[model samples]
Target: MSDVAEPAPSLARLGYSERWKALFAPMADDDFVPGRVMRIDRGIATVGTGAAVVAAEPAAHLVKTTGIGSRFAVGDWVALAMPETHERAIIEAILPRTSAFVRRQPGERETGQVVAANTDTIFIVQALAPRGPNLRRLERELVIAWDGGATPVVVLTKADLVSAADADAMREAVGAIAHGVDIQVVSGHTGQNISALRSYAEDDATIALFGASGVGKSTLVNRLVGADVQATREIRDSDGRGRHATVVREMIFLPDSGVIIDTPGMRALALWDADDGVSAAFPDIEEFAHACQFRDCTHTAEPGCAVLAAAETGELTDERLDSYQRLRKELEVSSARQNDKLRAEKKREDKIFSKAARRYWQSHPGQGGRD
Candidate 1:
């Protein structure tokens, strides 16, 4: 729901499966109509309700009770209420999300921003043209993807820009850090390896494409969906930076295949409650830490630190260790900030409740009022 608008298709066409059907069964006989959020723009959401896609206005009460993170997102299954007086349908409720790609909301707000929800696979797209792949960014991407409970596959796009030998070398370099994750090299221009990427889109599955701007994410989505469904713009030739061509997050259904959710290029992918993701992204480093002499080793200058020792003996790269430590510390700091924010909000709520209760008692003396 970050930006843009799109026409709705059916819920089944949007990759609604048995899992979603079962999850929605609880509200079967209710007046609510089930739909999947295809896109949301300017407080209005485009939802596909099994029968047809339509624009729906989110109910104010739904937004208030669920908070921001629980708000409607692309790929979310929602209950809709249609009124005769209104042109747009009303989003009454959002079903439980099986998975979500979330990040820390920017600028001093200690909260999570769910970019996309209910995704089964996340394509960590990194371009090979703009000075090859950024290993550090890839690590960050993997951490969030793992944290979001989605299987991540590294998609090395712009393969046409590099020679076959160079491509292989870059793949190996990326493989060193990616660990168990799959890596695929494809070119939107040449149409190479595009078919191989179809495996994730099979059987009503939902895939999310994530990367920085100008990484050919939109172009790749066009190829996957076999149409120019998303707009494409050229990256700046001088700096290799891409403009935000796809300014919004959207879900597009591929004919005879599964569905894909294309999101705007993320400029800042800060971690938000991604401890499990960090561990999953850097399993090797965690394994080494188990053998450290100190139980609370910071892995910086601690003596008998197995991680640092491994780095010294050339078993592990110092850069990779540093990335791990940096991300781990970031998570710790973010968690503390979030906890503080929650405490403050709770305190404010308690104060307001106490004030309201005192006023009620004062006004109703017959109801055992203390005043």
Candidate 2:
């Protein structure tokens, strides 16, 4: 590592702390500058330093890194190297993340994509307009949020379109799935609970807004920031479905409050290594799982299954128990797939190394025997 000083004061203004400073100390390089990634598009990233926001590009080494999780993501603190040949600074290294929101990469691959890094809270926004919030999706979102090492807070948006009674009912439904997490109800149109929502965006805290389109994530961000930083569009009147407004993931800093990372509406959020997250998200199921007859009981068809017994005796609802089993099975399958991928990768590497050794032996036949 090249010798460099601690992060500048400008970084402190953007949520830099002593923890990050200590992590950066060993990786510091004199030739590189430090900055936080605010936006990334088409292999280019917009990084915000205390002085100015600059566009940066990942270096060749960073590009060769395999999984999207290994690459630069919004909220990542990076070390930038200014090369004379290119106009954009090269992101040479990414600082260790305290927490990262990740989901399984789209398609058949077992890899994952890191959505955001170093996040303190994940605002799981769900609209309460056309229909009540999807508790199943909320449960899944909570799993990923907990898996990412960030606190999960459910935010029910579009309450203005629905009556207060309907909003309260929806909140109760969500509370069933949310467990101990805080649930906030807010309306961008009526400005209801906007102050309470703003309270989470305290100074130096990083919060990421995640939800489907038309969930009022952008509107909420605009309200909290006291400016229309993110563009908002009207949803389709017929279905109340919203268009993909925030197409990119971007970090917006609030002058008075903290920072907010806005992400586009996700079509799907598949699980990836969310075992602990599932247990944390479904504490009731985990609590019963401890009393299972067998340590590896599946709970579906097992003797002395406390989880199944709870469901049969009216202690737990069938829907909730089904959701728990479904998510648990998904996690098990994902773990198996990931293990297979790792073994395949190891075999490929061994084959490559073996071939290289054979070629070296042929080139230096006399010396190969001695060494």
Candidate 3:
């Protein structure tokens, strides 16, 4: 059974535009049709090629390619082979993405996992339930969202569980760290402010909901689409934490509007290639650094560090500065690891080429290089 329960939407409805047309025009293969990847199940992907949604597998190039890490994510527009058998569609290529929400693959050193692709906006869904959303985790989510090149909106869910005053207080706390991001509080129980979320998806934009488990992202998806597209599980307290987690990253086509991508609740969103993300997430810190005497001041115990001065005077919270410093250090460590990996790869490649060259020269007598 296909995970895409709704009828396959047209390519335009799937957020195809002139950009897609330009990309598809150069493809010499006339048998290929553009399609948006709806979901990936097992080794097969459910792709919506305007005509219909069909299960397809990636062609050898997409699978064997070295650099393209986790090539397909929901919201990616791909070139699908038009074969005689409708079920035999092959994903020949993945079009360049406008933005991708990526994080370090869990337990992997430097590999990145794409959570969503070609996303326009990301809702950093945080729960305002019995225990308020983890402020630290919310900040980290915002960093990844901004790093992905999509607009981040801090969405506080489960507002019904809290008093109106408490909800407002949580929103303000989020606003303090979220900087330029917009914040919205929606309660599924009261059906309050749910309609407003739809506006973010207007103009054929693709919005993805991202947060930790039990944030009500599944329930929010069903509500925003005005249907039971995503099955919601009861909030389980078996482990002292309520969770209604989605199984996989799935795309939901909103009726007469845009697309909404609901992703599996992530337990840990590790940082991956997120230098600009930290800068974007901590704009207030960046602003303060401009007035520092030394350009490379670490903002810790530096005599002329404006950031430290702000914290001392309560212009900036000590916690906020600490978060910025920690993320910056984390990004630096990730960068060093990636550099080492790349250098090792280059060294291995050179060794292989040298062996190949030696064999070629030995076979060709005086020939030392390819002509």
Candidate 4:
């Protein structure tokens, strides 16, 4: 007789939806077990297998080959291998991710970093206190989120600190920038309009909160969990910047709904590879591009360029167009570098194969003797 083991409580509690079931179908025949990564630090990660959360390390082969890109993050769905010894768990593979939030790390290194994976929605939180709201920063965040394959929702926190009229005005201003995306005003201190935000927390869904420092992201997270899971800190009065409140990216599962991943607030948001997002965020510019005389109009000095014409006529702000162009140029440069690396790799592989073929011929001279 075969032994039937009890299913993990956490996976059962999360409920097996058709979508998740489909996602798991590919792994059912494999020897690995499925789990959701809850936290990651150094080179290790804690994954929840519905039964229990366990600390694990990526298989040595995977790590020695690809470095950190293939390693686990907070929200990745990974496959685990349990050895006879219970102490050391091995993450053999990662399930295909539906969505991932990636950004360029702000440093001298020129590499993109994956902030969170498999997020269904991203709450781009911004504060209405102290210096009011930063529309430019919000616009940049929206572009990145949209490019990351997640729906972006603008959350204006700290409603209690601002006057009702001021809050309404801020909402309107944000609405103008967001276009059709949803915007919610909530007070983390007073617990206002949190119910509206709860709808996105449906079963099997995952949401991530991202924004600048002192934006009340941690406070909002505490309200949602119904406990102070995250620490709250005040912004410095002089510079209007706050200390890093949430240091690590961690996933917290809601009681009846889904999970939320909270990460430390970011200071610099450099564009990575968000051309599609730029187009979607600035639809007006995209629309004008279609009317250009040449199909591939650079829109800089080309004749009959509708985009540049729109900027000259004040239909589109030059500053907005400039920002769009700057991002596009960055994407082009990054793509070129990536393509060059790929070509170089292909050339090296070809050379190695030719060398191997020559060596094989030399070893078996009787099979095909030289003239």
C-alpha-based local distance difference test score of model 3: 0.85
Q: Can you write out model 4's per-residue Cα lDDT over 90-144, one digit (the tens) per residue?
A: 8877766677777776782345677888898999999888777798888888888
lDDT of each: 0.86, 0.84, 0.85, 0.79
* Residue-wise C-alpha lDDT for candidate 1, range 121-154, written one tens digit per residue: 9999999986999888999999999998999999
By TM-score rank, best first, the candidates go 3, 2, 1, 4
Candidate number with the higher lDDT (1 or 4) = 1
Q: Quick one: RMSD of model 3?
A: 3.2
Model 4 worst lDDT run, 10 consecutive residues: 1-10
* Model 2 regions lying over 4 Å from their true place: 1-9, 349-371
Stretches of model 4 off by over 4 angstroms after superposition = 1-9, 12-16, 65-69, 108-110, 234-238, 339-371
For model 2 the local lDDT of residue 59 reads 83
Off by over 4 Å in 1: 1-8, 66-69, 292-305, 347-371
The C-alpha TM-scores of every prediction are: 0.89, 0.90, 0.90, 0.85
Please write out the lDDT profile of model 2 over residues 1-371, one tens digit for every residue.
Answer: 22122332268767877887777676665677678888888767887766667778888887888876458899999888766677777888898888888899888658888989989999999999877798888889999999889998999988888999999999999998899999999987778898987777786889999987777799989888878899887646666564688899988877676788999988789998888898899898888889999998888999999989999998889989889889988988889988998999899999999889888888888874435
Tens-place lDDT per residue, model 3, 239-311, is 4255445777788888778999988789878899988899899999999999999998988787898999999
**Which residue pairs of candidate 4 clash?**
11-50
**Model 3 poorest ten-residue lDDT run:** 235-244
TM-score, predicted candidate 3 vs. hidden true structure: 0.90
